[model samples]
Target: MAAVPMDDPGRTPSSYWAATAAAGPDIPPFDGSERADIAVIGAGYTGLSAALYLAERGFSVLVLDANEPGWGASGRNNGQVVAALKHEPHEIEERFGKERGGELIRTIGEGPDLVFGLIERYGMPCDARRSGILTAAHSAASLADLQRRVDVWARRGAPLRLMSRSELESQSGTAFYPGGCIDPRGGAINPLGYARGLAAAVLQQGGHIRRQAHVRSIRRAASGWQVMLDSGSVMASRVIVGTNGYTDDLWPGLKRTFLPARTPQIVSRPLRDNLRKSILPVGQIMSDTRYLTVGVRMHADGRLHLGGGGGTAGADRPALYEQLPREARRLFPQLGDIEWEFRWSGFMAMTPDRYPRLFELAPDIAASLGYSGRGICTATIMGRELARWAAGEAAIDELVLPASSFRTLPYYALRGPIVEGTVLFHSLRGRLKTPG
Candidate 1:
C-alpha cells in the first residue's frame, strides 16, 4: 500500500460518523494480479457509488482504498445534503455557456432526490432527514445576495421560500439572522453511515471493495490500463480516480488543481429536551452567509453538531476547538457552559472557480474531484454519471457534466499561504458587516 500519511490533530483519524456507522465488511487488500472491467481508486462515496452502479449493470468492478471506506472527507463532512453549488447561476452560465449551463443546473438540482432515493432503495438505516436546509444571512449584504439566489431558483420552479427575520426566529432558535432562504428539496444525513451503506450496496451487487489497497500509479497499457498497488497490480479496461482532497501523486499533478482546506467540527453532549426543541425547532439543517461558513444541525440523538473554522491546510491550530464553542455560545447564548463531546477535522477540495470538474486524463482513465465542499449530493450523482460513461452507455460529451482539461495553479506550492490569506480577508469582511 502507498505509505499512509502520519496522523495529525488537524487530520482527524476518527470522527463521530465512524463511531456511529454500522460495522462494514472487512474486505482484505489486493495481494496479486486481478482482472476487471473497471478499476476504481478511493472507496469514498464517489468510488463506491460508481462501483455499485457499474456492478449492478453486470460489469466486473474492483474498488481499492488506502483505508476503510468513508475514512476520508466523505465520512468527515458536515453532513448537509444541499442541492446548490457555490457557483452563482450567472457564473455557471458564463463559464459553461447558457445551453450546457442549463443542463448543469438541472443535474445539480436533482442531487438531493438522487441521494435520498439511493438511501430508500437500499433501505439504509442512515439517519436521513429531508426536512429542508436553511441558509441564514449573517449580514444585510449577504441577505440581499441570498434573496437574489432565491429569485433565481424560484423562477426555476424550485420549492424555495424567503423567510423574514420574524419567521426565522423560531426556525433558527436565534434572532441573529435577519433573513434568508430555505430550499425544501435539500436535507441532511449521517454521512459516515451513508458511506458505509454505499459500501454494503456495492458488495451486495457483486462488486469487490479492498481496503488498505493503496494505488501507487496508473499507466496506459496495450490491453487498456494498469493500476499499480502496493503489493500487486491490477489490469483493467477502465480506471476511475475519485480520491478528492486525499488525492496524491498517483495521477501526476492532479493534487495541484485545487487546495485541500481543513475544516474542524465540534459536537456537543446531547442537549436537554427543552433545549433541543428550542434549537432548530423544525430539525432543519442550517448554515450562514459568513465567508468562514458554519453548518449546524441536530443529530437524531439530540446532540448538537457544528462544523466550521476553515484553516491552513492541516496545520495544527490549537484554538480551533476553543473558537467553535465560543462562536456556538454567541449564536445560542441561552445554552451556557455547553460541554463539547467530540472534535475532529476533514479536508475539502476547493477549486478557484468553486465548481466540480471531471477530467478524462487518458483515453481510458478518468477523474472527478474538486467538489468545493458540496460533495455529498454532487459526488453521488457524479458517480452515477461516471458509471454510465465508463460502461459506454453514454458518450463523454453526452454526460451531464462535460470533461475539462486539467489545469494546475502556477507555483502551486504557495497555495497554502494564498488560501489562508484569502480566508482571513473574508472572515474580517464578514465580521465587519455583521452586528456584534
Candidate 2:
C-alpha cells in the first residue's frame, strides 16, 4: 500500500528555516531501477548524514525522499543543537545499566561535537553558534531538578553551570525562571541550512539523492532488498529508514512504535536592536523545565523564535499558535506588541522510555527514530552509527545503541486523543506552577 503523505509531499513547508536557508541542490526524481551498496529512505538529516558518511567510505549509496531534503522535522525544528537526551545522565544509566547506559550517556553528551565538527568540516553556513543552551526552571521543584542535573553532568566532567534566579533574569531578560543550568556543549544552528548543506556534501561525496521519489514498499529479494517507488526502484544490500516522525506504514508496525507529537513554533519579525539585546543577550538557546517544555531562541536574523506543545491540531490552524505569542509576551514583557512573521508545526516522535531507539526491522534493514525533542544532535550522530553498521566497522550489537526489536506502543490507534489530553493536563499544571 502507498504510504500516507505528511503535509504536501511535493512542496516544502513555509518556515523561517525554509525562507532563510539556501536552496537545496538540484536533483531529479527516481525514474528507473538502480543498484547501490546501500539504499536509504528519507532525505532529512538522518538519511543525508548516513549517505554522506557511507559515500565517504567508498560505498555506493542512494537516498530517496518524497519531498526535497530537509522538508520534514529536520528543517522545521526549533534549531537548538542540544547535547543531551530527554532523560538525565543518571536516569539513563539507571535504566540501561551502568556499562551500556554510560556508553549511551557519553554518546549523547558528545553529540554536539559531531554536529559542530561536521558543520566546520563541510563549511556549512547554517548560522551555527556554540554559545551554549540553558534549561530554565519554571518552579522551585523544577529548579531542584535542574540542580540535580547540573550535579550529575558536572560529576562527569561536563562543562555545566547552575544559574541563580538573579543570574537567569540578567542573562535571559526574563524574571520568570527561578533558576537554570547551562551546558556549553550545546548550541544553535539554522537547521534547514544544515540539512541542505549535508545534502550538498552527500552529492559532493558521490552519493545520489532522488527527490519526490516516494517509496511504496521494501521487499526481500533473492539478493539484498528492493525499494519500490512510484516511478522506479532501488536494489541494495542494505537499507536504512530515517523518516522519523513523518514515518508511515511503509514498514509494518514501525509507525506504531512511537507517538508523534505536534510542536508548533512562531517566529517574530526581526526585533529592534534594543529588544534583541535585552532577550537572550548572550545568544544562548533555552528551553524551560515545564512538563510541556517551551523553547526560546533568537534566529540569526534577530527574529525571536518560540515553540511549545501543540496538542493534536493540524499546523494550518492559526488558533493552534495563538498561545505561543501569549507565552512569548509572558516571557519577555518588554515586547508589549510584537509581530509574528511565520507559524508552523512539525512532529517529533516520543518513545515510552523517552529514549531514541535503533531497531533491527529485519536482516540488513535497520531503522532509527524517536528522538523525543532532541533531534538536531542525536539524529546527526545516529547517521554516523548507521553508516558504521553498513560499512562493517561496527556490528549491530556493537553500535552505541545496540539494535533491538520494535516494541509497538500499546493503544497506538488512540495516540491522537491521548496526546491531546496529556497536553491539556500539562498545560493546566504548568500554568498553575507559573509565577505571576
Scored by TM-score, the top model is 2
lDDT of each: 0.83, 0.86
lDDT of 2 by residue, 297-373 (tens): 98767899998755452344577787888998899999999899998877888787778889989989998898888
Model 2 segments more than 4 A misplaced: 1-5, 313-315
Q: Relative to the unseen true structure, what is the C-alpha lDDT of residue 137 in candidate 2, on a scale of 0 to 100?
A: 88
Residues 339-421 of candidate 1: C-alpha lDDT, one tens digit per residue: 88888877788888778889888887888989988999889988998899899998767778878788987756876677778
Instruction: lDDT for model 2, please.
Output: 0.86
RMSD of 1: 2.5
Q: What lDDT score is found at residue 21 in candidate 1?
A: 71
Which runs in model 1 stand beyond 4 Å of their true positions? 1-12
